[model samples]
Target: MTAFHTDDPQPKPFRVADRLREAREAAGQQQKALAALLAWDPAKLSKTESGTRTAITEADVRAWADATGMSDEDRDETLEILAHFKVNEKSWRDRMRHGRRSVQLQYNELYRKSVRFRIFQTVWVPGILQTPGYARQVFTDLNELDPDTPRDVEADIRTRMARRDHLYDSNKSFEVILTEAVIRTLLVEPPTMLAQLVRLEDLLDLPNVRLGIIPQGRRVRTAPQSSFVMYDDLAIVEGFVIDNPYQGAQAERFAALMERFWADAVEGPEARQLLRQAITDLPK
Candidate 1:
C-alpha cells in the first residue's frame, strides 16, 4: 500500500440552507409563499431549503435574498458559504483521502441506524452481504487502484465483514434484489464466489432477510443502470469511484426505483434455487 492523499472532513451543505430558512422566517414568509413570490416550483424550494439539490444555484440564492429582504452583508455571506459548499459537494470521494477502512465504517454506521435496507446489484455483490473471502478479493483489487495514501486492505475487509452482524438484528429488515447477472458474473475467482453463494444461502434462514433474484427471462422494467442501496431514507449509488448519497425527495425516488426491479424478481424458495444452481454451475 502506497501513501495516497486523503480528503479532509466533509463540509455540511445544510449550513447555508439553514441561513436561508432563518432569513425567510425572519421576513415572515411561508415556504409556499416564498416559492410563489419567486415563481419557483414548491418542490424546488423544498429541495433548495433541504440542501439536497447538489448545490443551490446562485440565481436562486439571489432571488431568495431579494424575496426574503436579506441585507447586503447577509446575502454576501450566504453566497460565500454556498461557494465553499459547492466545492466540497462535487461528486467524488477518494478512498485514499477518507481511507478504505473509514468507508467501511461509514456503511456500518448506516446499517446500525437504518431499520430497513433495500439493496440492488447488477455488477457485484452488496458489500454487507459478501463473504470474507469474496470481500478480500474485492479490497485486494482496490489496493492497486490508488498509490498515494497509506493503504490497509485487511483492515477494510474486517470492517466490512463486521457489517454482516447487523443482518442478525431481528428488528431490522433486509430486502435485497439482484439481477441474474450478479450471480452469473465471475466478479471474483470461482472459490471465492462459491463461498459467497453459501453465505447468501445461509442468510435466507434469517426471518428478516428477503433475497430476491430477477432471473434470466424476466422483463426488466428498469434497465439496471447501476447498483444502489437504500438504507431507510438515504440512498447511496455505488459508482465505480464516487458514492452519491441522496436524502429527502431524492432518496424517496431511489426507493421507488428499487420497487420497479423488485416487481420482476423471484423470492422465497424460488430465489434460493437460483443460488443453488449458481453454486453447481461454478467452475471446479
Candidate 2:
C-alpha cells in the first residue's frame, strides 16, 4: 500500500488546506503554535497549507478547528468541505425513484468528460459496451423490478448508445475486466447475447481499448467486490442499495482492485479466444 497522494492537482485545488490556513491565521495563531496545540509537526501544518498534505482526516480537521478556536459555524462549514473530499454516497433506490433516465444522464455526463475509464463487471457487460439489443434487455429487466417507476425504455436505450460514442475517441482509453461468470450468464436472448459477444470481440481489437477476462478457478488478490467504475482519480463503487464515490485512501484502494483485475485476467489473444468460444456456445 502506498501513502495518500497530495501533490497532484487533480480533483481540483485542495480547498481544505486553504480554509485551514485562513482559519488559523484569523485565529491569530502561527503554524508552529497551531502545530504545538495539535501536537503535530510544524511541517505537517505548513505542508497542509501548501496543498501537499491532503490526507488529513476528519478527526484532524475537528482537532485543528477546536485547537484554533474557530467559531462553531466556521468549524462546521470547514468540516462540510472536508466531507466532500472524503466520500459522497447516494441511495440507488432514491436515485431510481426519479426514473432510470436521470441516472443514465448522470453517467452520460461523466462519460463525456472522462479521458480514461477502468471498469469491472462481475455479472453483466459494462453498460457502455453493451449492444442495443442487449441494453434494451437490461433496461427492460430493470423496469420489471419496479413497474411503478416511470420509464421510457426506448429513450434510455438511446442514451446508453450515445455513451458508446466515447469508445471511438482516439484520445480516450478504456480498460475493462469481466469475470468468467459474466461471460457465461444468459441475461438476454441467445441471439442478443451472441451479438453482444461480437461487439466485445471488436472492442478488444481497438488500440485504445483493452478487454480482459478473469477465467473461473484462478486465484486473485481479492474476492470480487460489487462492480464499479473508476473515472480518472475518482472511483464510483456500486453497492446493493447505493452508489458510493471514494476519494483519498478509499479511492486509492481501486489500485488494488485494478491489480486483482489484471492478476487473474487474460488479455490479447487469450481474451479473444474466450469471447469467441462464448459466442460459439450461444444457443443455435
Candidate 3:
C-alpha cells in the first residue's frame, strides 16, 4: 500500500477525542463531574475521550457542549468537528422523504463539482451512462424493493438524464469499471437494455470517459462487495440503509484497491465486443 499523504496526519478517532478532552479541560470540568452533570456513566465519557467508542452520535456532542458550558460560537465549532464522524454516512430513506428527485439533484451537484470520477459497479449499469428509458426502469425496480424510494420516478429519471451531460465536459474525466454480471443482469426489457448497451458504446467515443468490463467466468483477484464512486479523494459507497463516504486513509485505500480492480478488467475494443455480445444475447 502506498503512503497516502494529507496535510494533516492525525486520524479522525483521535481528532474527535482530543477535541472533547480539550473542551472539558478548558471549561475547568473534571471527567466525572461533567459525566454526572450530563447523567452519563463516567466510563462512557472515558471511552469517548479515549477513542474507544464504536460510534458517537450528534446528540452526544451537543450534550457535551452544553455540559462544558461551551459558548454558542464554541458549540457550533464543536458540532462541526462532530460532523466529521457522521457526514459521510447518510440514510437513503431520510434523503428520499422529499422525493428521489431531490437525491438525484444532489448527485447532479456532486457530479458537476468533481473533476475526476472512479466508478465501479457489480450490478446494474453505471448511473451517469444510463439512458433515460433505462434509468426510469432502474429507479422503478429499486422502488419496488425499497418502500422508502420516492414516488417521483419519472422526475428522478429526468434529473439523471441531465447528469449525463457531464460526460461530455472536457475538463472532467471518468473511469468506470463493471463486472460482466452487470451486463448479464436484466433490469429492463430486452429493447431498453439493448438501447443502454448502445449508449455505452456511444459514451466510449467521448474523450473524457474510459469504461472497462470484467469478463464473465474469468478468475479475478479483486472482489468488490458493492458499487462505489470515488470522486477525487472521497469514496462514496452504497450501504444497505445509507450512503457511506470514506475520507483520508480509508478513502485512499479503497481508491487504490479500485485501481487494481480496474486493471483486471478488459477495456477498449474488447470491452465493446463484450457489450455487443451481451446485446446479441438479449431476447428478440
* TM-scores of all candidate predictions against the true structure: 0.68, 0.66, 0.67
> Model 2: per-residue lDDT, tens digit, 1-284?
11223321123225788888888988899888889989999898888888766576789888988988878898888788777655421233355566778778877887888888899888879999999999998888877855766888988999889999899999889999999888789999999998899899999878999899998876787788689888877787753323556776887899678876798899999999999888888888
**Please, what is the whole-model Cα lDDT of each candidate in the order they appear?**
0.80, 0.79, 0.78
Model 1 C-alpha lDDT per residue in residues 238-279, reported as the tens digit of each score: 765446677779889888888888888988899899999999
Q: By lDDT, is 2 or 3 better?
A: 2
Per lDDT, what order, best first? 1, 2, 3
lDDT score, residue 244, model 2?
Answer: 58
**Weakest ten-residue segment in model 1 by summed lDDT:** 1-10
The true-versus-predicted C-alpha distance at residue 251 of model 2, in Å, is 1.1
The deviation in Å at residue 242 for candidate 3 is: 2.8
* Cα lDDT, model 2, residue 279: 87
Name every residue pair that clashes in candidate 1: 3-148, 3-149, 4-148, 4-149, 6-97, 7-97
Task: Write the residue-wise lDDT of candidate 3 on 25-87 in tens digits.
Answer: 999999999999989999999999987773787788888888887777877776776665454
